[model samples]
Target: MKKKTFWIPIIVFIVTTSVLYLCGHLFNIESLKWFNFEETSNGGFTFGGSLNPIIFGFVIGFIAEWIYKSRNKNRTA
Candidate 1:
């Protein structure tokens, strides 16, 4: 990813995941699962439903950014 587009993949994943989740509900499909995949079967209310993806997305984005940035940094140096 370029500097200007560094966040693109992660954002796309999050947005796509959200859209799929919504569509899953609309279409009565149970196959769609969050990338984080921590859904509880008890039908209880939990912030994990939303928080998991953000944390997962952030951690993934940070790791990818770190790796690509370091690769470029070392190459430039």
Candidate 2:
């Protein structure tokens, strides 16, 4: 990957992971089993999520990078 485009994937991965975690924590989405929130004595939820977010983030980031490259290619062609 080009140096310029490399940041795209990294940024996308960070953003995706953050948003998913936030949504899971705030909304308590039952669909995502990874965001296993356990209540503590303080009445606050603890994050027990798995690495699924990392994997999914990487995948989405790759797709975003590919799309960006394709668009840039077409524009320069």
- lDDT (C-alpha, whole model) for all candidates: 0.58, 0.80
Which pairs clash in the backbone of model 1?
A: none
List the candidate 1 regions with Cα displacement exceeding 4 Å: 8-48
Best by lDDT: 2
Query: How far is each candidate from the true structure, as Cα RMSD in Å?
Result: 7.2, 4.9
Say what the RMSD of model 1 is: 7.2
Error of 2 at 43 (Å): 19
Per-residue lDDT of model 1, residues 1-77, tens digit only: 37434675576557755766676557645454342244468965443233444455566666666776777789899
Please estimate how well model 2 matches the true structure, expressed as its whole-model Cα lDDT: 0.80
Query: Model 1: number of clashes?
Result: 0
The digit string of per-residue lDDT tens for model 2 on 1-77 reads: 48869898899999998777677667777543455667899888776656766788989999999999999999999
TM-scores of the candidates are 0.43, 0.69
Instruction: Report residue 42 deviation for candidate 1 (angstroms).
Output: 16
